[model samples]
Target chain A: MSRLKYDDVETGATIPERTFPVRRLDLVRYAGASGDFNPIHWNERFAKSVGLPDVIAHGMFTMAEAGRLITDWTGDPGSVVDYSVRFSAPVVVPDDDQGAEITVGGKVKSKNDDGTVTVMLTARSAGAKVLAKASAVVRLA
Target chain B: MAINPDYLGREYPAPEVYEVTRGKIREFAEAIDDLNPVYLDRASAKAMGHPDVIAPPTFPVILGMAGSALAIADPDLGVDFSRVVHGDQGFHYSRPLYAGDVLSTVTRITGIKALGGNELLTLETVAEAADGEHVVTASMMLVVRGS
Candidate 1:
């Protein structure tokens, strides 16, 4: 059940911000679950050889983290009818327990006539924006 | 090698059917650290009016990518896997995927463009249920880096 109601949302209402920790182990786990075992996502040497600074988290992983924030806020994964994002920058995850943190937040951009709302999301990691033009269209009760 | 622009508009038939299971949903939820009960417990999902446990919004990518691999791995496409990187992704869903649903996908190369010596290939995957219900449309952009 969605906590958000179409009649209750304001155009600028803020969705709570969330921070997800991404570690090297998490990247490995994501690779296994998603079947995207790109060496650059796990091999630091391969990453640097490819001109990347270090091992980076999968772009899909970052997008999934952002999706978590949206789903959590609405309380229903089904409420999200559309989602999209651009891989603006890589979330470099160092081999450490601390790893990296991705902070995601969003706001209601508009309300559609069909009881749906457009949300614009912002995701940042390592003090840099990792996703650009992130947005979702969500249906509300 | 640059991706073969001639492969544009190439379409691939649906790959093997993907069975959506509660375990896969739970695994995906844990992988992303999304501890949503609706994704784990059927009772919790039922409370939300879902017929069964529902997958995370991005869960379709797991199956969608598997289907698209047929196109990405085509020897004729001339794609160098080592040089490819994800550029963009988006999904439009007709409805959320539920546990016990069997899905199949057909992927097509929609566009291929050269930008600053790098090649960008756009692929769209249309997922449908066993009964031909349109489930989701996933679009992806891959950047093949210049040597």
Candidate 2:
């Protein structure tokens, strides 16, 4: 991992935006790994029964994708001292057309004197914020 | 059947300590298709000044669900597994969870309410290290559609 220097990042610097397409198989694997077997993530019948338009992706799955964006920008995932996020909307995984497009982006919110920087992040799908009030604190070297 | 709102503030015993490991972090990263080096290589983590390969920020989802899993799955909770949908989730971290940290979560039912005919259960789970230091806190809102 390339070390991100605390001196190099300027407040308001924006991380390059990244887009990841989530598929049903991705949700299946996540369900297995996370031990969350909710059929809303796999069975369309169950999802519709629960009032979801279709099978929806786990919120954590979206969170992980957003996390990848942060680690990618910081160059060192371990440098993140704190991370927090609020779920705003469900990333509905439709059975047809291009899957859910999760676009992740972040901008430096503040440069702290203690060598820590705050990043404000946003993850959107279908032109809506799937994750909101997202932010992370990275302790730079 | 609806869960009694009066049952709010019910706390469940914490789950056993789950020791975070580089292998698990790597597996989680791979499962998520996140190839971040700090979650795989300790050398890279060292280069980044971490004590060890650190798990992803959302890795606590697994650890945090231990206590609430029992509550939500309880037959008495009246939660219909077939009709429930994950409504929302939020996480707040006091510190980044690193490999080798033995942590456990204590989950509590903070609120149980009726929304129309469905049940909304709010859970707050707090994770702590074996040394008794707070690690992370996660709040989840689950909506169980009534039959």
Residue-wise C-alpha lDDT for candidate 1, range A1-141, written one tens digit per residue:
447678888999998888989999999999998889999999999999988899999999999999987888787888999999999998999999999999999999999999999999999998899999999999999
C-alpha lDDT of candidate 2 relative to the true structure:
0.81
Across B39-67, the per-residue lDDT of candidate 2 in tens digits comes to 88888777767788888877888875678
lDDT of 2 at B143: 79
DockQ of each: 0.86, 0.51
Q: CA lDDT of B86 in candidate 1? A: 91
| TM accuracy, model 1 | 0.97
Candidate 2 Cα errors over 4 Å, as ranges: A96-98, A112-115, B113-120, B145-147
Off by over 4 Å in 1: none
Candidate 2 per-residue C-alpha lDDT over A67-113 given as tens digits, one digit per residue, 9 for 90 to 100: 88877777876666666677777899988657788999999999998
- Clash pairs of candidate 1? none
Pairs of colliding residues, candidate 2:
none
Steric clashes per prediction:
0, 0
